[model samples]
Target: MSKKQKRVLIRILISSVLFAAGEVLIITGSNPFNEASLFAFFLIPYLIVGGDVLLDAIKNIIRGQIFDENFLMALATIGAFAIGEYPEGVAVMLFYQIGELFQSYAVNASRKSIASLMDIRPDYANIEIDGVLKQVDPEEVSVGDIIIVKPGERIPLDGVVKEGTSSVDTSALTGESLPRDLSEGNEALSGCINLNGVLSIQVTKEFGESTVSKILDLVENASSKKAKAENFITKFARYYTPVVVIGAALLAIIPPLLIDGALFSEWIQRALIFLVVSCPCALVISIPLGFFGGIGGASKCGVLIKGSNYLEVLAKTGMVVFDKTGTLTKGNFKVTEIYPAKGATIHKDEILKLAATAESYSDHPISTSLKEAYGIKIDRKQLESVEEISGYGVKAIVDGKRVYVGNAKLMEQCSIDFERKTTPGTLVYVAIENSYAGCIVIADEIKEDSADAVVNLKNAGVKRTIMLTGDSKAVGKMVAEELGLDEVYAELLPADKVNQLEELIKQKRLYGNLAFVGDGINDAPVLAEADVGIAMGGLGSDAAIEAADIVIMDDRPSKIVTAIEISRKTLKIVKQNIILALGIKGIVLLLGAFGMATMWEAVFADVGVSVIAILNAMRALDVSRYQG
Candidate 1:
């Protein structure tokens, strides 16, 4: 399928053929115990398998890229050959190439996982022109353009159903399993296929801003943001290689004169063993591979980690901060309670409709949700002379009558005689002809999983979980208590939230890292300041995702805990590999120095340790074992 794949197959083929021939030669008694001939037979296929690897090492040495794995491997094997250990030389090279191939396949597998995630890209878009079906580029389409979609096709842009109905699968974006049912006038997202029904949609956004493009872009570039830990090994090898090479030279020459005429073969043989033992295979290959595995594994769970540096920070976060609106609570405002004044003829719906209609001409959160609940589109013609007062609300002349929709302060300014209802939420009062009609109590409620997320974070080992919100003290306290949070601050402006995060970070500085999770344009400042900036609901503004170090694709705050769990697990694997690699290397290096170990031991130190570390790195695949 690829050049690397084809070459690996070729190497295996050559190794298999030569191996069989070598066994026949031994059995036929042409050379029953001629280890050199047996070694020659073994080395022929081994060289065919790994000749390119050896050549590359020599090329790099000539090109001044002298301190690399290839040079170390080449020097070690050639030294063995010079010491008249031909079979050992070939065996060492053969196993070293096998280890290199293992790491190569690991890289390919990681790319495939990310590619599967990116495959969510929609293949085509539907365009409606002159009452006829035609295909068009999604970029050429604009808002309000009608697009026809057949059954089992993905919608290329965010749009409303101008015609037709179907079940659309959204698992690509949210990891959600259910297929959502769509009807006329309902909105559908990109990356979702129209299943079992012909559909037409009015385009809402351009192709670049569509969910599919954003997701694919995010995943494709995920590896770029998150660098592997191997960078440290490269730096370590730069210094470590030359120092060890000099040490081996000293071991070869210095001991000979000091011992009153050291034998040439014995000293050179010991130096060769020293060279094999000091290949630095364990530190060079496994440490960084551990971090790469961690990052790739977390990506499979939709956590966009920016780098290993952040993964390290996340592993040590003892205190975590959160923004209230859109982070802890749902950003949408809802009518919590409706209070009707004495002798009012209107029920709750009638009061809601009047309020919805008065503010229908304006585009605001309170107005939008009110209009949504009315189940009727706003008639702009009926709404006349609409004027919005900044920091207040909108007032307009409708149906030859003046209508008002605003807070208690707006009502007080207008001298409306309406009784205020003391409640645990914001109160939107309605007035007709400057006379109070009724009030609708509204609040941005806590998300259903918010409390569970706090609990899970605690179980995930966070020492303290905090909430900082712009809402009133009562509302903030209610949510914090419900979620069983450790701390909370209410009625904070954007700057106040940052200041609070600063103080908490200072207090928690002694313990470990402090993480802040937010999904608001205003939260960008604080998100950048935290040790680990995690943004919930990455579908939020780019200002939020770009400012934060980690982005959760799903709105669930529980994913924050999942990310922490993943980081901890990843770090644990890294530690395990380090210990295993170093421990094995240490034992063999001592034995190699004393001539108690053979070339096989050197193979284990170089190639065998690498294979074990790689197998350990693949443990990052089982995310379910780490996630709660």
Candidate 2:
């Protein structure tokens, strides 16, 4: 318990002792005081337990805010004291204090749970200056600076390993226990711990732009965006409290006047019970706590939901659209096949060498694959001039021969007749001196979990699954069929992807949501246009991550299923709390107004219901049952 809660507990113990002593004296016929003096005796315990509540009520009344829980509590207990029910008034305040203490403890535990899940923030970066290691704030570390990470420290910035090899634990960032081994030239992200070897890393990004910083910013601001259920409760309490107070007042006055020989004290006691049972503490506190716990649970599964609003939308997702490259596929292209022209004397190695040399200056994935296949040095001196044709290919002069390396469009643009090949992988046509040459086949492998993700989404009751890609029709169809997607739209540009998503949005169910997942910079527009934008954060571009509403930190498609499960569970718990609080209060409220209930029953209606609802809200934080 917090120190503030500790003080409240001490006050409750002292007040209970005094209240019990007064009751014992009265029952034993040994009361030392008259009726007025006995009331004053009980006032000591009442003020001791509820002084802050009474003061708060008075302050709020002065500030034109007289219809809150504090006001209801203060009015009801004070009315009890006025009618010679001093012991009941003291008891009400003591029980209310106990409920408030439990509330404080529950909120604190939720906050600590979320704090521990996002505990990846580093305290300092180790930089070597003059062969001596010095610790500095992460913000002070600049790009290109070589920082040292020992076996037990977190990588403070995003960088590449320049020296040493180590096993890195990314469980804090990805929620997966498997450690990745990093060697020289491998990229190391922030928030991962170096487990064994000391590593020297050349920083590629500053602290502000690192992965850890972005995640922290997302989590800290999550509560600012409230779910619809939370908004309803805020408005409900605002209007509900004032109306109940007026009803209580009318019950206290109108009943005594209408019924013959009705005693004022008896009806007044019923009004006080009505007021106690009408406090909206359970609905007000438990709903938001449930959503907060849900977000923390999602972070444990490597999913970062921006706010509760997005979490709600995720539960209603009926359609899921995916971008092919870097999302469902590994996105690592390799030279799978090399085809030589049928009538040409050029060998396969010669075709590969010419294409690799002419396209050596480009950094595109296809170009990199060709260079990797050649596996030899390219002499740039043999090239006279090189020109790039966007969306086609490259034209260069190698050994004083005109060489054109690109797609079929490039071959046609140069007016070179080439053999057309119908292939399932990407095709690159090579032309030399305006003559036709063979084409190379490059392909990207599908991710191991892509099929599993599709199957799980279907099992989760998602109505449709689709893929939008810029790849050729042959390649896109192959991947879509392999993953068992329900629909596929291929050979689309960036603008075309958004248009397709808009058309899909029109076809979805009226209240259902559509989620678009992508990882490239080109996918940013389509991501923002979807009902929920999910980004693959592992190899995803910054533009995609910035526009996305939810991020899968480890680039696992399976985590989307986990996020949806968490959202549905949270909404179910919140609704359960609402019904549980209102159902019990409604029955007791009717009984209290009709004089069928007493002060002890009223305390149970308010304090006991709130404590039970809070305990139920805490269950949203347990996600172990959902994890495989």
Candidate 3:
């Protein structure tokens, strides 16, 4: 509880005791109204509990905001006092205050859940200055400066490890429980806990540009972007409160004048009850609170929803489009197959070694895979006069021999008649001195959870799941078939991906939206063009994260299903609160107008419904167990 809440709680306890004693005295005594001392004693407790509400009502009235719940509550209680129902007036105000306290407490608790995500911000960074380690603010650390991280300390900036090896816990950033192992030359992002070793790291980004700071900024400003449903409630209350106030006035006045048997006092009492029950407190408080809770719950599960508006859009998603490389697949290439031509006398390992040696100076992923497959250090001194062909591959002189490594086009240009390998992967053609050597096939491995992600999304009511990629048709078709995707588009450039997304958006069902998931720098345009852009944040580029509407911190495609489920469940709770509040209020408003209901029922209709709806909204916070 906050300090203000603690003080309000104390006041509630004190006032409840005094009110109980006053009630007993009133029942035991002859006439409390005739006794000035007893009347003043009861009024003291009333003011003690409800002074803030009364003061707020008056302040708002002066500010020209007269139709809010505070005004309704204050007016109804004062009306009770006017009618000489002092006990009823005091009890109504007391319960109203209690309801407000409950609301404040619930809101604060939900804020804490959302705010816990901000704990990743580091308090300080450790930098060595002339052999002396000094602690300073992370903002003071510059790029390229070497910083040291000890065991159990958070890495304060994004950087590369220069020395030492350790396991770092990334659960706070990624929501994955496993600790990632890091060694020299490995990259380490901020907000990760260095688990077991003292390491020296070269800072690559300043404090503001780090991943932790970016996430904090995104979360802190999220609430400013309201969902469509929340905006409706705001406008609904603006008009609804004033219309009810006018209706209560007409009920109190026109009925007494029109009906022959209607007494002014009875109709006035009904009008007071009407105003109390008419306050739009339940709808106003619970709808946005529910969205806020949903965002918090998603963050707990390693998904960052940019705003409530995006959450609303995600619930309406019927189609999901995916990028191939780093999204559904691991993005790491491996040499899975090798074929030697009939006349080539080289072994499979020899073919791989030649390709690895020729591509030693290249930093492409395919190059890396070839090097890794060779499993031996390359002698860079043997590679000479390397030239990169933009549309194909590299040409290098290896060990005093002219070696060419590229696609079929390079071999065709070199006049080498090579046997074309038809496979669902990237094929590299190697030619020695214009003679066809062999081919090495490298393929990207799909993620284990990707198939499950497709199934779960389908089960969650997604109409279609599609894959878009820059790979060949065969490779795209192979992955699509394995994952059971509905459609696949291959050999698309960055702009083509956006065109496909636009077409998919047009194909969506009326009221349904399209979501695009990606994890590469080239995917940024498509991510921004889709209705909901989801990024794989763990290994995704900064451009992708900046453009995406939601980020899966762990880079698991299955989390998209979890995110969709959270959105749907949150929308369900919001709709429930709306229906429950409106239904109960509508029925009781009729009863109160006809004199069938009393002031006690009016209090329940106003504060009781609000408390129930608020409790229902709280359910959106516990969505960790919600699975598609």
Q: Which tens-of-lDDT digit does each residue in 1-628 have in candidate 2?
A: 6788888899999999999999999899899999989998999999999999999989988999877767767876787777566886887787667656654454353223223444568999999999999999999999999999999999999999999877787644432233556878999989888887799999999998987776565444432232233455435756777788788889889988999999888887788778767766566567666776787788888887765667778888999999988899877778888888889999889889999999899765678899999999998898769997645678999988999998887888889988999988878999889998899998887888999999999999998999998777888898899899999999775557777988998977663789999886556667667878899989886656766778899998988899999999998998899999899999999998887887777767776787898799889889997667
Q: Which whole-number lDDT from 0 to 100 does residue 441 have in model 3?
A: 92
Q: How well does candidate 1 match the true structure, expressed as C-alpha RMSD?
A: 11.0
Better of 1 and 2 by TM-score: 1
Q: Rate the local accuracy (lDDT) of all candidates.
A: 0.71, 0.80, 0.79
Candidate 2 error regions (>4 Å)? 1-230, 238-243, 342-354, 357-364, 374-404, 409-416, 422-426, 431-437, 443-445, 469-478, 489-503, 508-511, 520-529
Q: What is the TM-score of each candidate against the true structure?
A: 0.63, 0.61, 0.64
lDDT of 2: 0.80
The alpha-carbon lDDT assigned to residue 553 of candidate 1 equals 78
Top candidate on lDDT is 2
Clashes counted in candidate 1 amount to: 1
For residue 408, give model 1's deviation from the true position in Å.
Answer: 2.3
Let me know the TM-score candidate 1 reaches against the reference structure: 0.63
RMSD to the true structure for each prediction, in A, is 11.0, 11.8, 10.3
What lDDT does candidate 2 reach at residue 286?
Answer: 72
- The residue-by-residue lDDT of candidate 3 on 467-573, one tens digit each, is 99877799899999999999999977555666677788888776378899988655666766777889999998676776677899999999999999999998999
Candidate 3 vs. true structure, TM-score: 0.64
For residues 1-628, write the lDDT of model 1, one tens digit per residue.
4588678767866776765665566568665656566666666876786688688877888898888666776777677666655545655565555545544554443232334423456766778568767887878888878888888788889888877766675544432223456778888778777766788788888889886676555444433443444545456667767876787787778777788767756766777887877765655556556666776677778877766667778999899888877777776777777777678876888678778888776555667667876778767777788877643566888777798888876888888888877677767888878877788887776888988889888887788988887667887788888889988898764556667877887876565788988876456556666787788745564556766778887777888887888888878887888788768877876787666888778778877887888788778667876454
Which scores better on TM-score, 2 or 3? 3
